[model samples]
Every structure is written in structure tokens, then in C-alpha cells.
Target: MTNVRKGVWRMKRELYKLLLMVLLAILPALSFAQGDPITQARIFVEQKQYEKAIDIYKKLYDQNPTNADVYTEYLNVLIQSKDLKGAEKLVGEQQKMRQHHPLSYVDMGRVYLAAGKDKKAEEQFDEAIKFINGDDLMTQQIANAFSTLGRDDYTLKTYERARDILKNPYFYSGPMSRLYAKSGQIEKAINTLLEAGPGQQGMLEDTKATLLEFLGTDKKNLQQAQKTLVKKINEQPENPYYAELLTWLYTQRDDWDGALLQIEALDERNKENGDRLLEFARYAAKEDKYEYAIKGYDAIIAKGAKLPYYSLAKSEKLGVLFAQLQANYAYKPSDVATVQKEYEAFFAEFPQYYTSESIRDYARLEARYANNPQKAVDLLTKALEQPALRKDIAGRVKLDLGDYYILTGKVWEASLLYSQVDKDFREDLLGEEARFRNAKLAYYRGDFQWAEGQLSVLKASTSELIANDALYLSVLILENITPDSNFVPIRRFAYADLLTFQNKDKEAETLLDSLLTAFPEHPLKDDILMQKAELAEKHREYARALTFLKEIHDKHAEDVLGDDAVFKIADINERYLKQNDEAKKYYELLIVNYPGSTYVQVARNRLAALQTGTPAIP
Candidate 1:
């Protein structure tokens, strides 16, 4: 009976083992049927195949109808892909599956934050905190959410709450302090960090230093900033940043001695270049330290650096010192001369160092401050010798020379210079200036005829400035001369005067063409033509003007002014300009041309006057 019981029990155990094997074998197939899709979906998730993972997760949810993890993972995938609508759908799925998962709210907040829906994110974070019963990580995350939304007020409140619940002040104190500082509650931020424990003490000191440095720029806050910086230095004596800050603060307060002390300390600390010494010189100069500026420049020169900028720096310093001396002792001639000599010496030493423009400036200083026209002239001439004087400088120097001559009352010399400047160049705006000056010199010399003639040509000049000036002067001369009929003879005479003034003998001779054209039998034609001849003679164009006068004696024998023309030509050729041989023939022509005319007596008088060196009246 026992054996039969043992066999039956063994068979029962065997039967149970067979059933377990059958169940084990079927389990994988069932799981394949049920879980293969989820596994493939999870693979898709891991591989970042979001759309496929979302589709498979949705199918798995439909099949199981209660798997919250499937919906959560699907939502994560949606969030990863930045699909807000799909994430929102997963949110609904979570509500259906679990009713209240804190992760669902947190994840929804994340989606809202990613989508820039700040208010939605805030609400989701609030909901997450409630679902999690104020979990520390969740509360901190809520604070981060507020920070991301730039809601500093909410962020501060959330962090304050988190700090209280977490019982650790350091949790958000650093960020809160920064937020306070950013919001301009700097004092409060400093106090808050100072109240924090030793781990943050150094950070508080650094923050205080930065805030004080910032405030140092304001006039109202400078004293307070000074105190704060001094405290920072005393606390961290080895910190170079604090030392530099104190140096800058001193400069801001215009405390040069303090700044220098700090700079010297910095120089010792870092083995810095001597450029700081140059900067000290600049600061001293700004304080009207002329002697100190010179000393500074001399010190740099003594250093034997041989830098190009060093030369320029010394030059600038010397210029400043010289300018100060000039301004201060301008009334003292000896002082002025002394400074002027120094500047001259400096220029002589560095002749090729400075640019032409700088040299021009120095020349102006010599002219204005030292009253040395010769020095000014020499400087400008030297500038002209430079190879790199630009066209503008060349033109300006020419104009300056013309001005110098005009100022010195050498009007004729100025005119000659101006005329030699090519009209093409003179026809530019500067050229107009040269031409205008030449014409003006003529006008100033009472040579209106010459002035107007030059003006007439200038009126057609290329420069609008020259043309306008010429048109104005021509109109003025024309208006003054052509007012009446009797002035016709005066006009003819004035034409000769104008031509003589301009040294245009040929044109003066041609002006007779107008007289001959206007009145063929005009009585004054002999006088008019004779005047042309006299102008030519006066200008040493005697051969040319004499030809016209001889024609008058030969052709206008009966004319009244012919004898006068002959005698005048003889007088001009003889005594005044020393052309004796030409004088005899014109004297004879005067006696032959109009024997009964009044000029015959004067012609004989001139003949006698020329022979015996007596004045002749006609």
C-alpha cells in the first residue's frame, strides 16, 4: 500500500512538473504576443525613434488599457520630439490611467516650459508640488520653472519656500543673491550672502568688491564705494583685483597721490612696463603739471626703449609743456622767446619725425604765439621740402604764402606769385582765391581798368567763386565808367590805362580798333590811337605803340590831336624812359602833322624840353 502511495505521489509530482514546463514554455510566446510590441517600442524610444515609439505606445495602451508607464514613456518621447500636442494627449492618458501621478504634472510642466507657455508651466509646477506633497526635488524644480519664466518674484518665493522645507539655507541662496543683485537690491544681496555660513563668505567678499566698484562711478556713491573697497583690500591684501580696484577708485576720485601709490604697488607686484610712468605723466599734465610732464617725458627717454611711440609721446609732452608756458607768460616777451626757442630746437632735433601737418600746426604756433613771421615762413618752406606733402597741403601752403605777402603790404609781389600758379589749379576753389587776390591787388592800387579787365576774364573762369567775383567787379567798373557820352574819350583813355596796368600792350593797341570801328571820322580817333601808342611806349613796347602813333601822323595829318600824339610820343621816347633816338623822329612828326594846331607850340616846347632837359607842357 505504501509503495502504491509513493508511486502515485511521484506521478502527481511528475504531473505538476509537466504542467509547469508547459506553462513555462507557453509564457515566452504569450509574452511575445503581448510584450514584443512594447519591447520594440522601447527600443525605438532608446534609439530616439519618437514617432514610431509614440505609435507603438499608443497601441500598447489600447491593448492593456491601464499601463500608466506606457503612457508616461510615450509622453517622454513626445516631449523629446518637442510635440506638445502629443504630450498633451499623453497627459490625458495619464489622467485616465493613474488619476494623479506627480511625474505627469512635472512632465507636463516641462512640455509647457519647452513650448514657452510660462503660465501653463507655472500651473503645472504648482500642480506637481501638490501631487508630490511638496517634494524637495519637485519644489526646487518649481523654482527653476519660475526662473526660466523670468518670474523673479515667483522664483524667489518658491526658492524661499524650498529653503524652509529643505532646512538648508545654501540650497538656493547663491542664485537668490544674484537675483537680488540683478534686481538692484545689491545691499540686501550682500547682507544675505554675509549672513550665510563660511562656505559662502569668500563669495560674499567678492560680490561686495564688485558692487562697490560699480558704485564708485557715481558721484553720490563714491565715498561709500571707497570705504567698501578699502575694507575689501584690508580683508584680502594679497588680491590683485582688489588692489587694482582701489587704484581705479582713487583715480575716479581724482586722488592722484593715492592712485600713484597703488600703481607703484601694482608695478612692484607684476613687474609691469614703464608705460604706467607715462600714464602718470599724463595724469600730472591733466592737473597742469607742466614740469612733471617734462620730467615724465625725460624719464621715458632715459629708459632707452627706442620705441617710435616713445618719440611721439615725448613730442606731445613737450608740446603741452610749451603751450602751457606760452599761455601763462604770453605777455612777457623774453619768456615767449625762450619757449619759442625751445620749440624750434625740438623741431630741429626731430625734423623728420613729425608729419607735415603737425609741422604746419607748429608753424602756426610760432606765428601766433611768438610773433615770428620769418620763423613761420621757414617752417612752411621746410614743410614744402617734404616728399609727402599732400596736394591739399601744397595748395594751402601756396595760399599761405600769398596771404603772408599780402599781410606784409607786398601786394605786387603777392600778385606775381598768384599769377604764376597755373590757372587750371587756380581755377579750383583755391585757384579762385589766388585769382581773386590778384584782381583785388589791382583794384587796391587804383587800377580799376586793369582790375576790371582781369575780372572780365575771371568771370568766365571755371571756378564759380572766381566767376562770381569777376562778374561783380566787372559790373562795378562798367557801372562807374559808362554813365555819360563825354566819358567816351575818358573810357578810351581808361582802356589804355587798364591795358598798361595789366602789362598788355598788344591788347591796348587793339583797343584802338574799337575807336576806329565806332567812328570812322571821329575827331578823337587821332587822340585815341595816340594814347594806345603812348601806353605801349610806357610799357617798353615802344615799337608797337609807336607804330600806331606814326600811322596817325601819316594818315591823320589834318586831325587836331595828331600833333599832340607826336609830341607826347617824342617826350616818352626821350627823357622819361631814356629812348633818345626814337624821340627826334616823333618831334619832327608833331611839327609836320598839324602846323596850325595848338599841339604844334607844345610839340616845339617838348622838342626844346627834351633837348635841354626842361619840363614840357601840352
Candidate 2:
């Protein structure tokens, strides 16, 4: 009886072991059932096992004929499998139960299209459109379905048929434009939107942005739009928007003269309040279109002081003229005198501007170019006394006044002003400028170690201009100062620089010559040569400046000043001597030999301008 019980227990254990083996054998198949059958079918589709997916979907469809998702998905799979007959039979079976379903006809059309039976496809598509009669929802579904199938022809016809059946003037220009662009009919796309009229004009910018997205920076589409704008202007002469857009196109093409012409015509035709002219003037200045900018500003000034933008235009015009002077560097004393009279008259008429940035330009012109340092000092001092001067503007004025003092040999007075500004604006650009100026003042006074210490801290200044000036001065002092700590030649060079700033060209020249004689083999040779070149350039001695620059370029070609000499030579030839060919040659040489030089990019740009007849971006 015990043996019989043991046999029974062993049999029970064997039965349990067999059951566990069966579960493990079918575990993966059972995992498929963990999700819905449709999910399993999708997984099979993802794996590209369409036959297996179809079998699973077929079982699901048979279980629930009312499942529209299953029905539609099964038919789509049939088409994807290239089984047009199977897709047709599925649709027919669905129609028997769902005769009023709109997607039946759409599916039939799609199936026919897949089979390349155009005649049958057209019939089914026509039936689908009939259901969309006067209904935007039906139209959208049909059109979007056709689009999903890449059948834009049927999609377009659906929209057209809907509009006719609804008897509505509504047109789908926005969507149609997208369709046209996709089909490579970009011109048609632009025209369709334009013809959509003012109700849809707000989409114009978006439409153009999309068109430009295709061919970036290719102004061909813009020119095409220009042609349309011209036609619109001719057809509707009273419309100013088209004129403005045309002007904008011209400006986009870097054709400032063209934009200027259009802007002037609009201003004359509309009798505007100088607002448009003033806006265009500022735009031209921003684009470096100085000629157009000057013309625009003059137009506003012609409106006289009675207009709203007159004072603003006059102020901006003063800066623009000074900018033109700086950009060309060809300003004569007579030019400065003319602008100087305008500046005096403006300040005399409006003393309130003394507290503004515009006042600084007058002082700069007077002191730096007009050779009237005392007049500049008096004007700035009067401007500083204003009770409502902004702290920043006051700081800037002090800094400028300090510079004038340095130029006029009042080193102690300049040091006081610089210290005042430095103390007041401790962490601002004004402070940085003041600190740099003070360091330079120290350098000028032969305090090399102290100046070097101050400049080392300023090399990391947040203001790029102050940082660069500090760095250059630091480098100049370090590179030229003798190992024995003798600074006599540097001190004389600084004094010569001061003299040059003071318009004492002859004295500065004499000092530079004496320094060269005293320090024949000194490391300050390149610096002395640069000083002489600057003095000669300032004195309108282009030939003399070329000689000095040539000496540095040929003898000191490996020095820190070599690139500077080459760049300065190119600049003089381009601007002062107007030797375009020579300027091109020098710029090319610098670009070739000094590929890593700071001036290489500017030289390349200038070379481009010389070769292309376009304005340099400077």
C-alpha cells in the first residue's frame, strides 16, 4: 500500500511538470493576446509581415462587421498589398450594411486609383464630390483624403466643386497656393494669394515667408513679386502699399537708389508729414546707404522746422554727415566749416539738446576735425552745466573734454577729468573709457609700469572698444619699452602723438625724426614709422604716408606693425590717393601673405567691392 501511494505521488509530479512545459511552449503566443488583436496586427505590419497582419485583421473584421476602424483598415491593407479586387469586395460588403457611409465611395475611388483604372476612379470620385454638395466638412474630408493619397488633382477639384455647388465666392487661395508651390508653380502661388484681395492681405507676409523658405536668399521670387507689385501700381495708381513694398524690394536687393526714388515719389504724391521720409532716412543709414540717407534727411529738412520730424531729422542729419565724413575720411576743412555752422545754429536754436548724445558730435567735429579745440572745450563745458543732464551723458562729456585737454597739452587737467568720470561711473562703459584714457595718460607721462598695470586689468573689460584700446596700448608699451627700463624714446613718441593730435604736424614730424635718429636700431622703429605715416596722412600728404608705410612693410614685415602698415597703405590708396588698382593690389597681397591677420576679412571685403562694383559692408 505504501508503494502504491509513492507511485501515485510520482504520477502527480509528472502531470504537474508536463503542464509547466506546455505553458512555456505557448508563452510567446499568449503574450500576443495580452494586447488586442488589432494591436498584434499593427505589430505585424510594422515588421513588414503584411500577410500575417491581414490574417489577424480578417479575423477581427469577421468577429465585428460594425467595427468601422477594422473595416477601413482591412481595406487599406488590401490596397497596400496590391489586392484591388479584395479591397473592392470589402467596400461592397461594407456598403451593403452601411449604404449611407461617405467613406465607402472614397475608399472605392482610392482603390480604383491604386489599380490605375482612371475611368473607374473618376466615377467614384465624382460620386464622392456629389455627397460634398454645399458642405465644407464633406469637402474637407474628401479633399484631405485625396491629398493623403497624393491625388492633388482630385483634391483641387473637390474644393472647386464645393465652391460652385455652395454658390459661395469663398476661395481657398491659401491652401491652393501651398498646393501650387508644391507643384513647382511658385509664380502662380504668389498671384493666387494676391488676387485673394484685401480680406486675405494679412497672410501676405506668411505667404512670402513660405515661398522664400524654399530658395533661401534667392531674390528671384522677390523680383517676381516686384513685377506683380508694379502691375498693381499701374492698375491702381492711388495705392501706396504697393509702392512701399516695391521700395522694400529694391532695398532688399541692395539697390538703395531705386528704393530712394520710389520713396520720394510716394512722399510727393501723398504729401506726407515727413514721417515716411524720416523712417526711410534712418533705414538707409542703418543699411550704410549714405547717399540715400543724406537725400532722405534733406527731404525732411526741406519740410522746415514746422513739421514733427524736423528737429529729429536735423539731429540725425548732423550725425549722418559726421558719419559720412568718418566713412570716407575725405572731409576737407571747408566741409567741416559748413557742418560746423549747421551745428552751431542747431545748438543755438535748441539748447536743450546739450544734455543729449547729439551734442557730443558737435564737440567731436569742432575739436577733432575743425581744429578748434578751445571751441570744443567751451561747447562741452556749457553742455555739462545743464541741470537735467543724464549721468551717463555727463560722464561721456567729461571723457570727451578730457581727450581735448590731452590733445591741447593739458595733461594734468585731462587727468583730473578722467579721474572724475572714472570715480562717478565705476562699472559702466564710460568708466572703462575713462580708465583706458587715464592709463593712456599715464603711458604718455612715461609711467610705464603703472600704465601697464592699469591696462592689464582693463584687457578683460566688457566694452569691446575699451578692451581693444587697452590691449593695443598695452602691447605697444610692452613691445617698445627697453629691457633696461629706459622709456625716453617711448616718451618722445607719446609726445609726438600728442603733438599730432594738436595739429602741430611740423613739430610732430620733427620729434618723430629725432626719435628715429636717437634710436636708430630701437624696437620703437615700427611705431615711429606709423606715427609719421599718420601725421602725413592727416596733413593730406598721401605720397609721404605711402613712403613711411612702405618702409615698415618692407623692413619690418615680421614685426607686430607689419599688417597695420599694409592695411594703412591700402586704405590711403583707396581713399586719399584714389589709386583703385594699387589699393586692390595691396589688399590682395595682405590677404595672401597675412591670412591670419586681423585685416584679412576687411581686405577680402574691400577686394570684393572693388571687383563687384558693390559697396563694402564697412
Deviating ranges (above 4 Å) for candidate 2: 1-189, 193-227, 230-243, 250-272, 482-485, 536-558, 562-615
Which window of ten consecutive residues has the lowest lDDT sum in model 2? 207-216
TM for every model, in the order presented, reads: 0.36, 0.67
- Residue 446, model 2: Cα distance from true site in angstroms: 1.7
Model 1 steric clash pairs:
426-431
Q: Each candidate: what lDDT?
A: 0.65, 0.82
| Winner by TM-score | 2
**Pairs that collide, model 2:** none
Off by over 4 Å in 1: 1-220, 224-247, 260-273, 277-309, 322-338, 354-356, 387-618
Per-residue lDDT, model 1, residue 323, is: 57
Estimate, for each residue in 53-150, the C-alpha lDDT of model 2 and write its tens digit: 89988999999989979987888788888878988988888867877656688788878888988899889877777777666677788888888878
Q: What is candidate 2's TM-score against the reference? A: 0.67
